[model samples]
Target: MPGVDHCLQEAMAIPGAVGASIVDYTTGFPVATTGAAPNSDHEAAAAGTADVIQAANSRSLFVSAMPHDLLEDLIITTAGGYHLLRMVQTEFDSRLVLYVWLDRVQGNLAVARRRMQKLADELVAT
Candidate 1:
């Protein structure tokens, strides 16, 4: 079972990964990070992404017709790269997300997503 740091390192090992972090969506705080921006400004990214996740989560509440799937990870694709967010399912109280930044030209989206899912499953909160 991987801890936060180990999981983050694994995330960054993905092909074309620019940076990776585990964030607490509720507080917009990163629990662990690597390859983060110049000054480790992942805090801002966490806060921003958390808002997006929250919005999607909120929609699932009022929309009865919504599929049983409700909300899953969020992905944003830009001309330069891809931003992938995988929500971690844990037994504890923390609502965590795995955030990965990848180079658009080098990253394989399908592979990245699959690996992220595996990483999420392997996580064991401590």
Candidate 2:
């Protein structure tokens, strides 16, 4: 399996990929990150994402609906880029996530998502 850095590099190799990071959802901490803009603040981004996920989950429960067996993945598209967030279901209570940013002009959302799914399978927590 590839290391975390190598995994992020491979993600960037995908057409239109701009940045990628492996994050820990429980604490909203980044295990590794790559290709963000010069002034991007990854820590803040991760924390915010975690909060978003938690809110979504809570909303589902409040609606009297069970959450998806698992979150599997999430995608957000903006005027400038596409953000892909995938939760990695490891063997413990702790969960991990892959956060990716793709340039909309060049990115193929389907392909990027497929590549991220494959990479997540190969990533192992140490």
Candidate 3:
């Protein structure tokens, strides 16, 4: 199985990927990161990611009614780029978030989303 750093490197390989990071949502700390972050600040980007995740999880507006259903992913699109966030589900309670930024003009949201899902799975694979 690939480690966290490798997972991020693979994420960066996705077309139009500007940056990628594996963040601990619980603490808003980045475990690993690659490429350029928004505003050239990975620390701020990671914290913002965690805040978004925390809000999504805390609010009922985004939750599903189905039994055992959990939030799997989130996508935020801006005029210039896209922000993709995938949850890393593990055997234990997982607090990891795989985040990637892609240029809107060159990136395919469908492909990035799919690849991110796969990468997130690899992060927890033993």
Candidate 4:
């Protein structure tokens, strides 16, 4: 398994990748990051994205339908680019998220998502 640093490096290597970070949602802290910094302030972006994840996870309409399903990931596509958030289950923490910002014109959403999922699966905290 790749450690957090290695995982972040691999994430940044993805085509059209603008930024990437591993966030601990419970505390709104980023465990690792690379490429462009979100919002010129990674801390703020980490906090904000944590809120996004929490909001998505709490929706009764979605969660009620699959009570046993843990959130896998969340994607937000904009006119200019895409924000992909992949959840990583950890033995040491209750919540972790891999967030990557990609350029829409150059990125393949399907490929990025698949690679992100694979990275999440191989990620291990160091």
Candidate 5:
């Protein structure tokens, strides 16, 4: 099983990955990080990520009609790149997210999403 640092390294290995981090959405704090961050500020980026997640979780529009359904991931596209957020599903109630930033022109959204899903799935084994 991979630890946080190793998981992040794997995340950065993805094509066009600009930055990657594991964040505690509940506190808007970064648990681990690698590569370049937006605005050269990982803290701000994490907080902003948390805010977006909090909004989605709280809003009924984002919710599903199925009682067992849960939010899995979110992809936000920008003029410069793609912001990917994969909710880490743990055995407990802890709120966590795997965040990845990729260059829009160089990154393959389909590939990145698939890789993020795999990474998130493995985290539970740690």
Candidate 6:
């Protein structure tokens, strides 16, 4: 299985990829990170992203009826880049997510999504 660093490296290689982080959704903490912008707070972003996911799930009526299945993925677009979040489902209750930032001018969203999915599958947590 690919390690977390390897996974982040592969993500950075993607067209338009600027930064990436592997996060623990349960604790809203980053397990690994790469290519953060100068002066950017990656930890805060990871925590905020987790909060957004939790808030969305909690506030959605449809989600309330279903079992507490982890969120699979999320995508957000900004003026400069795209943010892609992919959740890794594990046997344990803890869920992991990959947070990727890609430049809008250079990134291929479709390819990034596919690669993130593959990477998520290959990751083996120790």
Best candidate per lDDT, number?
5
Model 6 TM-score on a 0 to 1 scale: 0.85
Tens-place lDDT per residue, model 6, 1-126, is 577799899989988899999888767898898998424988888888788677766676655475776467888888888899887877677667888999999998999999999888888544
Candidate 4 residue-wise lDDT, 23-74, digit = tens: 9898889888887866678888899889998888885467446657778889
Off by over 4 Å in 5: none
Question: So what's the TM-score on candidate 3?
Answer: 0.94
Candidate 1 stretches with Cα past 4 Å from truth are 38-40, 60-68
Q: Tell me the lDDT of candidate 1.
A: 0.83
In TM-score terms, which candidate is top?
5
RMSD of 3: 1.2
RMSD of candidate 4 to the truth, in angstroms, is: 2.0
Candidate lDDT values, in order: 0.83, 0.80, 0.91, 0.87, 0.92, 0.82
lDDT of 3 by residue, 1-126 (tens): 688888889999999999999899989998899999999999899999999999888776646657677899999999999999999898897588899999999899999999999988877776
- Give the TM-scores of the predictions, in the order they appear: 0.87, 0.85, 0.94, 0.91, 0.95, 0.85
Task: List model 1 lDDT by residue over 1-126, tens digit each.
Answer: 677889889999999999998888888887888896424588888788788778767755653355676455888998989999998988778788889999999999999999999999889644
Q: Sort all candidates by lDDT, best to worst.
A: 5, 3, 4, 1, 6, 2
Evaluate model 4: give its TM-score.
0.91
* lDDT for model 5: 0.92
lDDT of 6 at 32: 90
Candidate 2, pairs of clashing residues: none
RMSD of each: 2.7, 2.8, 1.2, 2.0, 1.2, 2.5
